[model samples]
Target: MELSVTAVILTLTAILCLYYWNNRGRRSRLPPGPPALPLIGNSLHIDKRAPDRSLIQLGRKYGPVFTIWLGPRPAVVLCGYKAVKEALVDQADDFGARGTIPSISKVTNGYGIASSNGPRSRQLRSFAITALGHRGNGTSTLEGFVQQEAETLVEAFTKTQELPFDPTFRLTCATANIMCAVVFGCRFDHTDPKLLALLHMMDENMKVISSPWGQLYDLLPNLLDCLPGPHNRLFENANKIKSFLREMIQLHKDTHREGTPRDFIESFLAKMDEEKGNPRSEFNDENLLLSTFNIFLAGTDTTGSTMRWGLLIFLKYPEVQEKIQSEIDREIGMDRTPCMGDREKMPYTNAAIHEIQRYANIIPLNLPHTVTRDTEFRGFLIPKGMLVIPLLSSVLYDPSCWETPKSFNINHFLDERGQLKHKDAFLPFSIGNRMCIGEKVAEMQLFIFLTTLLQKFTFRSPVEPSAIDISPLSSGFSTLHHPYQLYCIPRRPARRPASE
Candidate 1:
């Protein structure tokens, strides 16, 4: 009995020593951070509800660049404008690779750009950017489609008659319809049941994926795989979106002719046929489904969420909205639809939109980046395959970068002459080669959609402007604005005054 007890004690001591040395070696190789426990690592330390905020706070204590263990995985987080710019901008090639989030990877099966790495990602992303840039022979320009959707949105808002209504559905359909036209060569009616359900799934999936549950699934995927929770719903939603896209693909397969590609999907299908005999060809049905999924999901949610946040900000600061409206009316006139050309001329409206994006800080914790090689950055060496997070919230809200980092001030993007001032840190689409590919497209949609809305309606908050809570419900991978209703009073070209 005495010998057995001594052996057990010796074994425990050995295990502890091994764990200590292992962690010590890791810390020596990575940037220093808060002490993390074995297995769970820093999970307990992070505010699950707002991991990005927690990471930002740690950035305060640990300097601009620091390391944290997510489960057993160590991630190097680049905070503020300088650190993020250094790694993602100065050392772009080193930090350009995409990192795996288990939650997203499982759904994507490591297939698309969102989760793909190396050659596959390069091939797919190149095709995607080119495809997005192309115009279908018989279709209207993307701008024309957006303008038409803006008119449809106008019709939808006018139906509310200055009463309280949630803009989520209409905004979603409008923004998503652009991508729908690009990918599927068609648009869904505002009342389409399938579109509505797909949007509902996407919205919830984003919520759950940004939630603590989603973080855990990313951190400890294998352990959580057998467990039951809302995190599992993401996979279910993925499958549903898969079925939806698969059906769309099948329809395209039947209708799409060889050589002459009509839509994004057909373009991809054409590529797939070209690469049929090549063993390394990444063009296949799986890639097609996932690439489309990534395009559609991303194309829909980020812009949709940004627009919602934009409207929410408008409700909070009526002056900002009025000023933008005044600028729109002055530049574009209440008669003509707002155009991209008008953007260069409308300084205040341009500043307001830029400020809105900065204030909104969508994708606060940018999709994680990876170092494919051992990289030395800012006096610290990041190991190859280590996950890196370019904390965009830090950059957008960095005091050193923005004059009024904490406030929703248009002056952040404005000069004394009231001209739009471009800040190097205004990167809601993030920076580097891996940045959001839809930047220009999103910019046009935002300018047209917003200017069109303000041209037609003066939006009013349901609550007192003082009571309007523009703070997001949760902040992580995405900042989800709290659901709120607002009233829309028509302007000149839309309709006569409600009272008149």
Candidate 2:
């Protein structure tokens, strides 16, 4: 009976694929791509683990702007700096819509800024940016919170005391605390059970999302939904986070004071109450919960991973670390903590941080975008609802754009005079309307946390710097550096100590 059921299911799947295959040619003037097979489409041809690499190779053959069918659905990929810029930046409106990614949709339930489109997405995104900015004003309060966390982080590293140790949890905790302060209006104790669980869930979700299994779940969610796999755990983890958020929302509602918004949640709750009667209002408990989830999750992973990568890179390149430390010593000195304002005077340190982001290329295949309407783009006719990916890896590593795209050279962001220079192609947070909502917060975190560490310690790895592998261990939604232990040796102070 089981065999018969399996056979029937396969037959139905084959028929559906045939139907999609037959209708595929009906769409006219679609971007060019490699020929795809029935049911699987280009799944066989592409590398699930490193889809960006596969897509980059495909871009070379099919030109910068081309199509590749994920399953039955065809996605138009804008590759290289020029192509991605044209679509995401120059032609922003046409490609502003968010694609219905099954994996994210399942978790987000078609709500929140990451998955929502049209008015809802716009409303939430705008409100989120405003709320996040208000919370993370980058001046007094936010900087204080970050600097405090950096001190805690330095303390944690000092505990290691020249012993090689993994800095993942310490880094993640520091980063997550910043998010907690911004979103939840508080910070989590390093030993808090709930906070630890939350961080674990966030880390697991990130790993799963960036895993090949995660891509498979996204590609064939329905089938994978039925089968037993890690995807199920992914959904379960999302529910746990959502449940936590829901509980927090209720607590906020119970304690919320009108006209006195504490943080992102209070501000959103206020909006939800204001728009309570409007039928078209996107502000609600569901959105508030999911939007909070989106911010917390996004805020934690990207910044945490980047900082971890920065430390690893520092261990890999001690000379670069020394350069940044010297700049910090000369400009700010050890008595005072590094702040965003100091980023202006420290060109080499600024360039190194930018280089870390560019080299990290964390989110290589940025959040998938879609066509707002049936639009004509770059001599090709892209229909509405088509999945559009502005390959950020292509842009960040485009040979024509950077002096040395492949290498981790800070000179890419430095002029001949060794002053900081801006490169238009640095889109690690992506570009235009749907770019990362937490870009500013992430930037602040990276600059402050990294500079703080550099000021406090000189990092060295167990193995020789040249032996360290800078290439990511995994690459799907994001590129994660291979886990490695490093020694954090505290630097002697050059200035008088300030009062704690």
User: Count of backbone clashes for each model?
Assistant: 0, 0
Cα lDDT tens digits, model 2, 287-360, are: 88888888988889989999988989998999999999999999989889898999889999999999999999
Which model scores highest in TM-score?
Answer: 2
Per-prediction TM-score to the true structure, in the order listed: 0.93, 0.95
Q: Which stretches of candidate 2 lie over 4 Å from their true place?
A: 1-26, 494-500
Q: Candidate 2: how large is its RMSD?
A: 3.2
Model 1: lDDT of residue 318: 89
What residue pairs clash in candidate 2, if any at all?
none
